[model samples]
Target: MSQIRLYDTTLRDGTQAEDISFLVADKVRIAEMLDDLGIHYIEGGWPGSNPKDIAFFKEIRNISLKQAKIAAFGSTRRARVKPEDDDNIRTLIQAEPDTITIFGKSWDFHVREALRISLEQNLELINDSLVYLKQHVGEVIYDAEHFFDGYKANPAYALQTLKAAADADVDCIVLCDTNGGSLPFEIADIIDDVRKHISTPLGIHAHNDSECAVANSLTAVEHGAVHVQGTINGFGERCGNANLCSIAPALTLKMNRPCMTEDQLRQLRIASRTVYELANLVPNKHQPYVGNSAFAHKGGVHVSAIQRHPETYEHIRPEKVGNLTRVLVSDLSGRSNILAKAEQFNIDLDSKDPVTQEILETIKNLENQGFQFEGAEASFELMMRRALGTLRHFFSVLGFRVIDTKRHGDDNPLSEATIQVKVGGKIEHTAAEGRGPVNALDHALRKALEKFYPQLKQMKLLDYKVRVLPAGRGTASITRVLIESGDKNSRWGTVGVSDNIIDASYQALIDAIQYKLVQDYAADKKE
Candidate 1:
């Protein structure tokens, strides 16, 4: 099998995703990780787009990547403009990436309507753009914007667009499913047709509007595409682009196509998670391949089957992609599930222990009250500790009160909280002001406890997420708060649920703090 080149456009196209933004530091960090993951090319955003992108190109030039070539993305020169004179093309040259990718119109509709130029002029633009870039860069990848749609509308014109690049001796011509509406079979047939027309190496850049980006991309490869362009976790503008996490495993494990090395393939989940973490996005628990639920077993039968023969219920070994098999405790879970979860936490308990049964019943009861332990592993661990009589009572919250006030039409509202806590039989009271009620509560609680345990200073809240269980449940519905806390070494997530939003947040916040203290106690014992 021939090796497929993986081109990640997360810094470029992936940033087009709503709410996704990256600083120069983030782009450099992600590029390094992608290189470490054995990606062949990393599209380091368009050099002419924004100041941040420009800064990224400047900064990335200093870092020496081991395996991947950095590509700067831009569009072909305008219809009437000379490629050398075009500002976008000039910027790409200035960025000095050895590889440059530029998109030109393949659709006749775009030629006649979007670019408002004759068909001949569009072909000239494509030729001139690649011809000019070829001189400055070692390799030029020509992306045919809306290529599949163009081919469907006017195959002759689409073929002409690719022919222009091939005539200019471009290294690669990418067929882009820009609108993301093309199906897998359609993409396969079109790629077959495209292969018949152009001898240049073909690539596929697909979007996920039809939820077939990964399938379409894979189909294109199976048909003959040598290059695959996508983003981590399928992040892009509308539905998203093809997910490289899904594509890489499918290609390497299923198709027998070599994309990354065996070691690099194992780093898929870590890379996916790192990208999500840097983007401040909550990972999709159910995302295929790298998601939290990808290998998680909930049903008793499935868990039992997995324990006996993992291949019976699993498609692949969980560790193959740097993931682990998760046996969640729920109403549907059996003794095997409890034992598995306990083993992960290194708890010594037999499946037949009365305490294990009690914990299972408690989980079921709490889940009945809309508490999901699956997403809140820390909270579940703490619950088990409490049940098993090993829980460390770091501190007890006596009570907390929040006061909000705004005077004289002031734009900023004042939030204050007074907290009362009992630490090892000593009572401490503290009051603090913060930007919000939760912030105030956090400040007051920390202030009261920091004196007793200075190690609390090392831990801080990393992220806070709140979700109302069901949509349209209104203000009276139950709210679940998941708080992510981290110190110098590790991070943990704890969950809290309540009808009152603040109370839910408080529960998560306290759990986060207590979890930190528990770690401290365990470390002390180890010492």
Candidate 2:
């Protein structure tokens, strides 16, 4: 299969996403991650756009990369300036990239209206920008902005625009769906038409307004496109750009034309996660290759078949995409789910054991009352242990109160919470301030517990998430909390469910701490 180049714009277009922002350091870290994932080209940013991109380019040089060449994305020289003198072109040159992609007007309307230049002047910018960039970089990719629409409106002008860049010896001419509203059939038709005219290699840049970005990009490649441009996790303007996560897999796994290295396919999800985490936005759960929910199974019948044979329900092996299969526990769970969920905790259960039946019974009752064990693994373990009489509590919650004391001079915005507890034949009290009463209460609870087991400090809350089940069911219904925690290398998860948010969170928190202590105790026992 021919090698296709992947141009990642997570730093440039991804940052343009609504409500998405990443610090310079965040951009650098994600770049390194993409490099490690073996992506060929990482469009670091449009340094000519703003100071953030400037700072990103400068600071990122200090870090080491694995297999990615930096590319700077920008437009061709302005309508009135020489390509070499244009600030955008010069900035793209100075950014010191191995490659530069500059978009030029492919539409007559953009030439007459947007650039306010004669079609000839616009064509001059395309050729001159490519020539200048070729002098500064090893590769120059020219994007034909709105090429599909332009081709439909005026095929001669659009083909002429690409002819100019091809004559300038640009490495790739990328057909951009600038408006993002083009259909896949239109993309396929125009790319075939353009291919017949231009000898230069074709590339694709698609947007997702009609939700056809991925489809259009794939269609282009099927016809003869060589380069693909996208952002990690589909982060971009409006509905976002074509998602490289989907594109890479489609090209490599589905089409057998890998745009990147073989190893890149393995670290794909990790790469997606690194970008989302850096942006501080939760990764989409249904995102095709990398999502947490991608391979998750909740149905009892599905879990049983998977237990007997994995091929019954799984489409592609979860590990094929760097994700693991998850057997979720819910109120709809049956024996298979309980057994599978227990295995995740390394707990062995005998089918005929009385305690096994007791555990399932307890789960059903709690779930009927409003518990979602899938989110609260720790709580499930605690319940299982209680069934087998192996669970033990260090202390019990006597009372937790938030005193509405006058906001001190620098009092916390959230209320001050104090926790009182009975332990070791005596009552202990502690207080702390946090962003919220639950946070304060957690600190105080941990503070109190540390007196008994100092090892509790090694524990940390890695993730905390809450959801109200069957919303509009009123406040007295079920609330669920999922908590994932770790010491350093090992991460364990737990779930808690209750009618109250505070209660659900507290249950999940305690389960997390207890699970950590259990692991610590086991490690010490081995020692």
Clashing pairs in 2: 376-495, 377-494, 377-495, 378-494, 378-495
RMSD of each: 2.7, 3.0
Pick by lDDT: which candidate is best?
Answer: 1
TM-score: model 2 vs. ground truth: 0.90
Return the lDDT, model 2, position 58. 81
State the lDDT of candidate 2 residue by residue for 1-527, as single tens digits: 45888888888888888988988888888888888776788888898989998887788777777668888889988877898788998898888877888888999988898888898998888898888888888988898989888888899999999999999999999999988999989988888888888999999999999999999989988999888989888999999999999898788777889666666677888888887877778788888879988888998899999999998998777776688888887766778887887788777887777776677788778777667765556667777777777766667768887644556778646657677777668788888776676677678788877888788887787787887888677877678878887787577777777877877777777778777776777688889
TM-score leader: 1
lDDT of each: 0.91, 0.83
- For all candidates, the clash counts are 0, 5
Candidate 1 local lDDT, residue 133: 90
Per-candidate TM equals 0.91, 0.90
| Candidate 2 ranges with C-alpha deviation above 4 Å | 60-64, 260-262, 398-435, 461-487, 490-501
Candidate 2 whole-model C-alpha lDDT, 0 to 1 = 0.83
